[model samples]
Target chain A: NSKVIQTPRYLVKGQGQKAKMRCIPEKGHPVVFWYQQNKNNEFKFLINFQNQEVLQQIDMTEKRFSAECPSNSPCSLEIQSSEAGDSALYLCASSLSRHAETLYFGSGTRLTVL
Target chain B: GDSVTQTEGLVTLTEGLPVMLNCTYQSTYSPFLFWYVQHLNEAPKLLLKSFTDNKRPEHQGFHATLHKSSSSFHLQKSSAQLSDSALYYCALRYTGANTGKLTFGHGTILRVHP
Candidate 1:
């Protein structure tokens, strides 16, 4: 069992609808990361934050995804307009720090777009 | 850009047989190698990581050695177990500008039968 927590084990949304998922990083962890696992089991890095500051993100995430990790609130990743290609397993992981090599991942939220 | 390549998409084996999964990588800088295992409907968990000192990393009877010259970190186990069936991903973290980002390869599914 991982210490990281993700909400809504499954989510379904229609095209052009909004979809959101939440994740709570492990206690004492200051760095958080989000990844997408497609049907082919290929992993794509979306974004990462260190103590509420965005460290790096992909161009696709910048254009289509909204993500934030605020203090005293669970981190969130929301898609303004869900698309069929966006359907995937959203995984949230956390580490001790920006330089930590090991990441503790949560059970992902499976999103389906129709 | 950093990328990992897993040559085999699937490997089927009988229980008690030796296990080996090939993994190679390309990176501009010397990166940290990691292996993550995901069981059915479960979160991915770290299996092994490469040591900077060139020592082999092992866990649960699995081991991998990072070879900088070959840019490879092949996973191996002397004997396969039924419970070891899962999706295995090879990833690399660039220790350069973006330390939080991880580049992952298409996962290799391991099927161990009795």
Candidate 2:
């Protein structure tokens, strides 16, 4: 059965507004990842975390975009100011370890910025 | 930095026809290769993963072999099915890097016509 869950299956935001998406990783999974899929079907790695610490994030994500996986709380990715270019499918995935022999993904949150 | 290249942007095949999707990678270190399939409006799911100890990985009648010399892990199937129609992405995780992020290819859309 699928374990990863993402809230707000679809989101619509206006330009300059904040867009936030949440994810719940599978139980006992310590590693979580986020990616963005664009219209061209390209998957771009956004950020990843191990436990409660941020591991690696891309340059584009270092600014404007803030993400955290707090202990006992759901992981989240937030866009400070939504842009039409930010409109895409945000995917959340979880793995048992950072090595990630396997990864389970949620249905994803499709964000539309107008 | 690790990178993956999926030669085909799209493939159209008839049911029961042989299928092969080319995937090649570039990494300084021995990389962990993976194949993920995404149905429309769905999150990508792991289809096959390369284990260092295993020569070939197979799932759901799909299989791939990791060749270190070629830096390739091409996904192949004996026959294509209509259900197999989806977007396939090839990804790689560099063990040499401390990050758990996976670099993905542009993805290939497979259309199996009945």
- Give one clash count per candidate, in the order shown: 0, 0
Q: Tell me the lDDT of model 1 at B4.
A: 94
lDDT of 2 at B77: 99
For model 1, residues A1-114, the per-residue Cα lDDT tens digits are 889999989999999999999999999999899999999999989999998999999898999899999999999999999999999999999998666368999999999999
lDDT of 1: 0.93
Q: After superposition, which runs of candidate 2 have C-alpha atoms over 4 Å from their true positions?
A: none
lDDT of 1 by residue, B15-71 (tens): 999999999999888889999999999999999999889899999999999999999
Regions of candidate 1 where Cα sits further than 4 Å from its true position: none
Model 2 chain A weakest lDDT span, ten residues long: A95-104
lDDT of each: 0.93, 0.91
- Candidate 2 clashing pairs, residues 3+ apart or interchain: none
**TM-score for chain B of all predictions:** 0.97, 0.96
lDDT at A1, model 2: 48
lDDT of 1 at B7: 98
Cα misplacement distance, residue B45 of candidate 1 (Å): 0.2
Q: Alpha carbon lDDT of residue A97, candidate 1? A: 69
